[model samples]
Target: MDAIPYLNIILRLTIWFLLTADLSVANIIIGISIAFLLPRHFASPEPLREWMRVLWEIIIAIPQAYLEAIQIMLRPHDEEEIVRERVKPKRTPGLIFLDIFLITFTPKTIVLKYEEQGWYKVHRVRRKISDQ
Candidate 1:
């Protein structure tokens, strides 16, 4: 069995405990049952390395997002444009969702749509350059 299912269950249980704030035996059982019973859509299970790469990307994006926000604030005069960008070829629904979230989390870019042909229609804002 892949570790992803176990990880999912663990995450669900954590959320359950956090939300219910009850660590009683009955609540533990209920949380475990709910975690297992919850519907999961499994795509052709992505390799563990791929998942790790996505996780690393997410970590890197946090500081990048802060930098982008600072840049946006310092340069208020910006131009917005839509651009098409290629996405990873092997994309699952979870990966696509995460990709969109990462892109949109940054202040300067938002993913408008994911195309059928593995492209992202991205809306981007950049500081406009002017002749001084």
Candidate 2:
């Protein structure tokens, strides 16, 4: 209701019009006409601000993570390498059972497969929006 409080609404409308303007200058004219024709709702700005921040962070983090994954994947590695297990092999049945139980219960990451000379994949979903 105060001066310049309507700035974001004006800016968003301008963006929407600009987005639609590629059709022609007629669209640009139409977009401009709409700014005047539309009444300002002046809704509370908090929800919009929170969503903007969340969307922005997601836009930034997703590509960064992808780039990181690519970097790790493309890094040079020796075709043949040997490493010693830091701990001696265990023969405990209870520990294995407990491990299985925990892995099954955990949600975000899932173990695809595990074995000697086999591959294991962990799938994780990034939570972007928090439940209010």
lDDT (10s digit) by residue, model 1, range 25-121: 9999999999999888777866777767876897899999999888878878468899998889888766676688788878889999999889999
Model-by-model lDDT, in order?
0.83, 0.45
Clashes of 2: 0
Query: Which candidate wins on TM-score?
Result: 1
Q: Model 1 Cα RMSD, Å?
A: 4.1
Collision count for each candidate, in order: 0, 0
What residue pairs clash in candidate 1, if any at all? Answer: none
CA displacement after TM-score superposition, residue 90 of candidate 2 (Å): 58
For candidate 2, lDDT tens digit of each residue in 1-92? 54233544455565666667565778766776776676655444434444344346545655665665565466632233222222113412
